[model samples]
Target: MTPKRVVIAGAGQGGFQVAASLRQDGFDGEVLLVGDEPGLPYQRPPLSKEYIKTGNADRLLFRNADFFEKNAIRYLDGRRLAAIHRADATVELDDGQVHGFDHLVLALGARNRRLPIAGMELEGVMQLRTLADAERIRTAIAPGLSLVVIGGGFIGLEIAATAAAAGAKVTVLEATDRLMSRVVSPAISAHFLAMHRASGVDIRLGTMARGIRDNGRGRAAAVEIEGGAVDADLVLVSAGIVPNVEIAEAAGLYVQDGIRVNDLMETSAAEISAIGDCASFPFGHDGTLIRLESVQNAIDQAKCVVQRLLGRPEPYDKVPWFWSDQAAFKLQIAGLTAGADHQVARPSDDGAKLTVHCFRHGALIGVETVNAPGDHMMARKLLALATPPTLETVEAAGYDLKAVFAAVSA
Candidate 1:
């Protein structure tokens, strides 16, 4: 039974992929993409990096107007889903438009998590999530301005580096001792810590940013720390994000950290599938489910779900990969690095390249490469192998991933 009408909520990258993939895969169905934001779907990663400096909003667009018209996609921008009627297979938008759907795909992305700290209401404090937010920061940033970033994650560090390069006095306050502790190995964290500090950016580790201090004019004056306040003309909160799953939960779907979905990306109820950041899909590891916020997950899961709807039911199992560009360094990672008990760091002779291999129970779990594109590409190929080389094989190869990969391929 081919679905006639397919409604996808949240026109972010995932939702856009689902709609585009459906048409590209020869599905002659009605595709409706409803987005809360007004405009074409754009790339978010550059909002903090390239957009902060260049302000080229036009380059961020995934597709222009003609693609939608040619593909016959009914795009409803500036619309939010109010409720989902699972029984009737229809969704009501905030504008009171009830659209019937043979299949509903929830590509709802995540929103920035606002921490409960004082002085967050200040005028100069902001969070980078949308194009409008980036515009505000680009207009506000200037040479000799004091910028304080509250988180030391990839986004915060990348923003810090960009600001510093623009002649802004950048300061990063990380609550944890190691930078990117939750994702990367300590070796990779240490490398970035040194790289950032060498670029004249002040980085404070294990330092909690308690609150923002307000200026007399209702603006941010400084960021209050354990010792004292640091003067801040602008403040950026990169405290991570929370998945948007309220609509799914309201419709009585199972919700954990995110909207829970099966291997086929189907939700608790049939004819409804969930993908992207809002979906916690089964990982085929120890029967546990993990939600990824990377672009790879969004694109791959969308394709997987569309295939299922087209009667080709293949499970969504793809290698996870992520990348971050800070200053001159590009860090790329493959596979899940969580719960890794051991790490082996390999640095080039000139100190220009490095890769950190993470192992769990003597098996390779993940690989993090800094400024090494070749290693990063090989790491992804290696991880996709059914039986990746063990820690011993890697050690025997003198921690040379290229040689290890070549031998395995041989």
Candidate 2:
């Protein structure tokens, strides 16, 4: 049965992509893309990087208004989805408008996790998840001002670097022992730590921020940590994100860490599907479920959902990849490194490039490369192979990624 209309909730990258891909697949059904945020869908990655320097919000738009009109896709901005009536096959809006759909897609992305500490609501303190948040950050940051970042994740580090470049006295508080400890190898973390510190970023690892000190004037005065406090004019809470799974859970969808989905992106409820940051699918090599919060993950899963909706279901098996740019350094990772039992680190002759090969039970599972795009690309190809190159082969090649790839392909 063909869907008469497709109502998609949460108009982020994944939601927007679903509507466009559906049209591309020749589905002329009524497509309604609803989002709580005003204006068209925009890329969120640049909110911490280019948008900080440029401050041009127009450049962040993923598609112009004409594209939607041209494609006959209905876009509803500033409209929140209040409820999903599965039996009625309709979604109720906060405005009391109810729309029926033959199929429903929940691309409801994640929201920034809150910092559960005193003075969280104080002025000059903010989180970076939306364009509006970034604009606030730009307004708060200035020359010679004190900026304390609350996490060592990508967004926090990126913001720290940007702030430092803008002449702000920057300090980073990471609860873990090393920068990006949960994601990258320790060697890569050390390299970035040196890079950021050389650029005048004060990094404090194993530091727990107990609370925020608020000035009587209604602004964040400092971040209170163990035994001391770091004075700050602004605070950026880039701790992490929580999936927007309330509606899914309320609708009785299978909700675990996120909305549980299968390889085809179908929710436990047959007619409903979930994708993007909010969907936890069994894509892990060990069959463990996981959700990714990257643009690549959202966009690729959106395309896969379209294929499945068009009666050409294919498993969502795209190799996961991610990148983070902090100042002049670019860190890239190919494949998942979650449970890697061992890792091999290699660096260039000039120490400008580095790569870390991760293995689980002696099988190559992932690769992390810094300032080495060529090697990162090769690593992607190598990991995609049916027979991944062995650890011995990688060492025998003397960490020459090209040679290792050639040897394996030959």
Candidate 3:
């Protein structure tokens, strides 16, 4: 059955891509891109990086009003999806606007997780997941401003670097022993730790922020730790994100860490599909079911679902990749490094470039690169191969990635 109408539930990157890809694929059906925000879909990454540094919202947009009109995508901004009526193949908006669909794509995305602190609701406390959040933080950043960031992950550190560069008194409080412990390797973490510190950002490792102290005037004044508190005019809670899976869960679809989906990006319901950060599918590398929060996953998964709907069903097997821009350093990862028993760290002569090759069961599985774009690009190709170069091969070649790739292909 041909899809006459496709209603996308979330208008983030993934949802926008689906609508755009469908139009590019020559789908003339009714494509409605619904979003909670009252504007065209924009890139979320720059909200913490480029947007923070330049304060230019123009660079964040994925498309303009003219593009949507030209492509025939019915974009509904500031509209929230209230319910999914799967029985009738319809979705209900919060304003009671019911729209029927032959196919429904859920790109609901995720929300910033809240800290269990007392002063969380106080003024000067912020979280950055949307344009509004970025605008809130933008007005708070200034020279000599005391800002304390809780969580040393990519978002936290990125904000810390940008704020510090902007002459703000920035301090990072990471509960973990190392920065980005859940994602990057220890060597990469140490290098970035040094980089942020050198840039005048005070990063405290293994430091747990128990609570936020309220000022006498009813705002967040300090971050209370074990023995002392870090005084701050601004507190950024970048603890992590929680997927917006409530609607899917309320509809009784299989919901785990995210909306559970198969390799084909199909939800428990055959007619409904989930993609991007909100969907937990089998990891393309190791087949370990996991959800990713990256632009690569969002765009690739959107393309995959479109292909399936267009009668060319292929397994969602794109190699996952990610990048973080903190000041001058650009850290990129080619694949999942989780559960890798062996890892080899290689660096350039000047100690500026690095690549951490992770191997599992003697096979190259993932690579973490810092300021090494060439190696990062090659790592993605290597991980995509049916037979990636082994740890021994890389070691024998003196970690010459290009040579190993040529040898493997040859």
Candidate 4:
């Protein structure tokens, strides 16, 4: 049966895409997007980059008030999903309001993993997840102020670079041996490590932050790490994120690392589906269930769900792509880097571009490019092909990726 009404939970990137895709897919069903945050849905990537510098909240919105009205998508902002009555096909809000739906979409995004150390509740200690969090950090940032960032992931590095550019004495503490150890290749990590360090940011690897030390006035004064304490007026914890799956878990959904969903983005329950960062679905060559926190993943999964809802069911198999801006370099990645066995680095003619080709058993698995949009675009195009360019082809072309693609086609 076609659903007459659809209720979407959470209004992050995925949640916003669900409503827009439904309209684009010719679904006339009444759409209800419920979010815990107030105001229109906004893009989160800029919260750590441009938004920090400009403080322009208006530019972050995905759609303004009129877009919702024009599309007939009802938005319930600043409300929490209290309970999900699976049998009754209804969702109750924290305000005691219950809404019935023939179909339900859970776009519940992840929350920042909290630092368990002491003095964490003190003022000036913050986490970046929402626009409000970015505003707090912006208000706290000042020239010559000590800013300590925990974790060297994309968010942490971006914040460190931005703060350093703004004249804050920034220090980053990462528990991992190298920056972005769990994601990017070692070559890429080394590049960024040097980039950040050269930009005057102190990056400490394999350093664990034991606790945050509070100043006499109840504000964070320093972060205690291994061997010594790094004095700071502000501390930003970008350690990681925990998926928001309390409501899904309570409703008896198959919850693994995240809400488990099949390729069609359907949950174990017939009417309920999950997408975006909070949902784990099978992908990759090994078909392992993994949840990705990229905007591309969220948007692609939402489109797949919309297709299924429109009676054209297809597996979600979009190739993952991601990018980050730190200091003067723009790092772009195509395909998954997990389980890659070897990598080849190619420096461009002028020395401005560098592309790292990752391979697993001689097959091109992923590509990481620095300040090279053409290479990144070509990599994405090649990854989408039925028979992608191989490592031999790349090496034969003398690392000129465009030549490799041309040779393969010719």
How high is the lDDT of residue 204 in model 2?
Answer: 99
lDDT of 3 at 331: 96
Q: Write the per-residue lDDT of candidate 4 for residues 1-410, one digit (tens) a residue.
A: 67999999999999999999999889998999999998899999999999999999999999889999999999999999889999899999999999999999999999999988998899989999999999999888999999999999999999999999999999999998999888899988998998899999999999999999988889999999878899998999998999998999999999989899999999989799999999999986678989999999999999998988999899888889999999789999999886799998877878777889999889888899999999999888888877777788888988777897888889
What tens digits encode model 1's per-residue C-alpha lDDT throughout 1-410? 77999999989889999999999999998999999998998879898889999999999999999999999999999999999998888999999999999999999999998979998889999998899999999988899999999999999998999999999999999999989988899999999999999999999999899999988889999999998988999999999899999999999999989999999999999889999999998885675879999899999999998998899999887889999999999999999887789988989889999999989999888899989989888888888888878999889888888888987888
Query: In angstroms, how far off is 330's CA in candidate 2?
Result: 0.7
Candidate 3 lDDT over residue span 1-410, tens digit each: 65889999999999999999999998888999899997778999999998987888888999788999999899999999999988898999998899999999999999999988789998999999999899889888999999999999999999999999999999999998999999988889999999999999999999999999999888999999999999999999999999999999988899989999999999999899999999999874457789999999999999998988888999988888999999899999998886688888988999989899998899888999999999999999988897788988988878988989988888
Per-candidate TM equals 0.98, 0.98, 0.99, 0.98
> Taking the tens digit of each residue's C-alpha lDDT, what string does model 2 give over 121-148?
9998899999889999988789999999
lDDT of each: 0.92, 0.92, 0.92, 0.92
Error of 3 at 361 (Å): 1.6
Pairs that collide, model 4: none
Q: Once superposed on the true structure, which residue ranges of model 3 sit more than 4 Å away at CA? A: none
Q: What are the clash counts of all predictions, listed in order?
A: 0, 0, 0, 0
lDDT of 1 at 153: 96
- For each of the candidates, the C-alpha root-mean-square deviation to the true structure, in angstroms, is 1.0, 1.1, 0.9, 1.1
Checking candidate 1 for backbone clashes, the offending pairs are: none
Steric clash pairs (candidate 3): none
